[model samples]
Target chain A: MPSAASSQLLDADFPTRLREVAGMVETRLDALLPKPNGHQSVIFEAARYAALGGGKRLRPFLVVETARMLGGSLDEALSVGCALECLHVYSLVHDDLPCMDDDDLRRGKPTVHRAYGDAIAVLAGDALLTRSFGILGEVDLPADVKVKLVTELAMSGGMSGMIGGQVVDITVAEGERDEALITELQAMKTGALIDYAVRAGGYVAGASETELAALSAYARDMGLAFQIQDDILDVTGDAETVGKAVGKDADLGKATFVSILGLEGAQHRAKELGERAKNRLAPWDKAAQTLRDTVDFVLERKH
Target chain B: MPSAASSQLLDADFPTRLREVAGMVETRLDALLPKPNGHQSVIFEAARYAALGGGKRLRPFLVVETARMLGGSLDEALSVGCALECLHVYSLVHDDLPCMDDDDLRRGKPTVHRAYGDAIAVLAGDALLTRSFGILGEVDLPADVKVKLVTELAMSGGMSGMIGGQVVDITVAEGERDEALITELQAMKTGALIDYAVRAGGYVAGASETELAALSAYARDMGLAFQIQDDILDVTGDAETVGKAVGKDADLGKATFVSILGLEGAQHRAKELGERAKNRLAPWDKAAQTLRDTVDFVLERKH
Candidate 1:
């Protein structure tokens, strides 16, 4: 394994650190997405339009920071991080399709389907998802590491994970208020990728078993906390700030954390999850401060 | 690399051997597809419906046959073949969506979207595509081999391959009839995966550069021949035998090989391509008989 230089640290605010990583990730993503060419140029164009030019880059941040904390190569972390971002953006593009969530706006711009039409949106999403795996395959990592990352990433986003959650979400019967089902849906749909992002960082670092376990725990709690905050934001935040339709969950009568737990109860649960998430990284002490700060950011963010 | 026991061959007819391979692929696919479970059971069910008990298993047959001829492990070949099938099926499922091909029938049965609703169908397609990579990741091959397979498969099916072809097919501007453009589209959409299927078997066998080159040449010609035959069948074959809508290309006025070359010209081209494809395999002599026979099968197939 290539040794990662422990970069010098500054006591910068958490948002500043996040923005810095986001900027780096964006540059990498721009470089990574395929250039448009020939007859099939439109799909590449659509894929780039969807993947680039938007989003929090939260997953990429988690991947990079976790690898940094675990003393993993920054370059490898960025590749994996960019891959995760591609997968995330593809999901968003598909989710915004007419047959799915049918949303017009994504990241405050017309959704892929709206901008490129449904067929192109679907094809672009397909392209992005395939490119995600391709990115991992091409990353300068050990063969074994690459295999594990590909396997785990596919599992996280496939039938039993994100896709499965999406099926459940779309098929939820009206007036069914099962928090357990809703939680499972959220965990599978959203939490799985988030968890994988952190674990992927650990994998790249070749961290010890104990370190991996801690990261896994940190990711699980943090993922739930992130979702809860999203639900909270949907209720409280405006559409312009949120970048998409808000309160649509309520409008469609879909069950959410806020609906089942109540707004304050959901907020309390998220806080508890955030605290637990931070506590999981306690053993790493100062090295994990950035990750701990991330939990607070997940809870406190308005959009 | 593991040594493959060169299995004894029977002097069986070509159709019999093809059927034997297809049966084995179907059995393996049955075992590989994830079983239905819990809230996300629908996607799994739908994926199974689309993947199992249908199609010619042409790609899988190519993988297995090429590997067998090259003296590669049957088990590894089967796994790779199954993975290719999953990827192929996913593309078919997505292509049959209302906003795409809008075909209600596939393999003489209701399409995934027709049976499971559009949302479930979309999720099912996503799951299958992800599972295709996951299969490659978990295959008992050298990790480098797995990574290469993953990368190449993604490239064959992603923005520059099948998905790109589909976009061109859908977005074909009216009154535009460019044979070169159509050929490019067909090569990307259909030929890419077919080429990859044969090459994957060669990859598994650790074939020499010369052998790989020969396989590449054979696959390229065979792929075009197969596509040309498909166009001919679309015009002349009955829907019941074809197991899907026929005459649709003509109905849509799509620029197919038959449209551009005329039926006799298309037939002549396919025959010429098939002969060239067969000649590419001549160096292997008796060892490549089954694959050479596949060229004849491609040209003569009614469906």
Candidate 2:
């Protein structure tokens, strides 16, 4: 991990903060899920396994941190964070299905289908996706906020958002590979959920339209930087450290950022985009420091 | 087709009404989804194939009729109805995957995976599932109603609901078969969505708590009747009329109502449950007449 950007900000223990957010998110996820004691205990167990104990929790971190930055309650923000993470995990579970990405590992462990069966994994994913909507029905929050969050999640998480991108990805993998298509795919498949995460945080906090717009721009740029770097890492990184098979994208003949732009070009683009993302938050003061560094971290992440 | 219950009610135009609702649902679904124009158009095409053209739209029919009975606008009820139907289609698409039910046919046609391949089918299911939540963020309804609908959907459709039942169904298939287990499985898988359909209709229509309770009870009984009869049909119905593979449960060694209770016992139970379902609606007047027949129709349906 590049320590420079995160270490320099707000006397930041950047790793510590990520770990803290992940801890809180895991606890919330644990509470949010049903215990694995029902007649269909295996499904619940599989769902819990898919969601509960791993990953960086970066999306939830965005929701929690962004909400807190805009004067939202940690408790409520955490709820929304948990919901988004549930959805994120759901997508991962499905993506790893035998018919999809067909990965045997996720977040350094055997994927849900690998541990359980494909049938349970599919149901587990379905369960997680459903929870994303249900968890937002917080009576304490203004009803409009709840509706807005659900809409944001659905629009980004659904057809025109994540799934659409996934469709494009599958098609591209099967046929021709191009940078423009890859960009669109990354935007839809990955960026959409990231957009939802940040916007939801700001939405619940009642951020001004201007603030929301800025956040969107910042998130879009940061998302691009993250994906390009991810592609680059896939080409150059190690499987053990990356927690998945690396060089797999190239092996699959899928066009990626590193394919369209050479490794050096992609690295340059990521840094520039990270800078642009941080610059969008120039209006914010000290509270925005972590977000700025998050962009930087995205630019520099190895996995 | 058994025309007994449908022939007796609403000028004996019950079949016509059902057809009308199905048409309306198809039109609405067509409008809701994107045209297949993108580079990844095949997935969109497959999604449309799954959702746009067919099915009895039984779930939406319940939603529309129940809402109309409770004084909700047909148009708005249709919105919720479309969302529910979309989710139902999503479940069907995923369930038919090779790793799950592995059926090659559905709704008298090739399954989505058969027509569009597995990757597209997976993405199509995800798109539909996401849209179900996204569409509910309509500006027209009260925010509380939207939240309630999303929550209701999530609860019924999620782990504790439909997906949970599916998990149990898959697990039971791998193990021993039993009536008690089958009943529990049916409740979670099929009954939860059925419950959500009726309860959501009442919820959006501003039904009182007691009214919602009655609707829940009625839907529960109707759902059980529907599932029991479905199991019976699997034993006795023809594959051509039933659309997909029948005798699948028996071939898979899965416990079902027919397997547990025998054909006659299951049929008798379904009739009794249908009667009980109708009795719950006694508190309503003429408006609920269609719903009562719906219960009868559930008992009498051949496929």
Q: Every prediction's TM-score for the first chain?
A: 0.92, 0.93
DockQ, candidate 2, comes to 0.73
- TM-score (all chains, Cα) for each model: 0.93, 0.93
Per-residue CA lDDT of model 1 for A1-303, tens digit only, reads 111122123235888999889999989998999788887688889998998886779999999999999899999999999999999998998898888878998767889999999989988988999999999999999999999999999999998888888888777685774778878888899889988999999989998889888888888898888988998999999988876679988998778899989999998898788778877887777788888778877777777
Residues A49-131, candidate 2, lDDT per residue (tens digit)?
A: 99987788999999888988898887888989999998999999999998888989886689999999888888888888888
Off by over 4 Å in 1: A1-12, A236-253, B1-12, B238-252
lDDT of each: 0.87, 0.84
Candidate 1's docking class is: medium
DockQ for each numbered candidate: 0.78, 0.73
Chain B TM-score in each of the candidates: 0.92, 0.92
In candidate 2, what are the lDDT values of residues B1-303, reduced to their tens digit? 223454244346678889999999989889887888776677778889999878888899998999899988889889899999989999999999998879898866899999988878877888898889887886368998888889888888887888888877666554565766777777888998888888888976889999999999988898989988888889899988776579998997766787778889998899888877877887886568788878767767777
* Residue A274 of model 2, lDDT score: 83
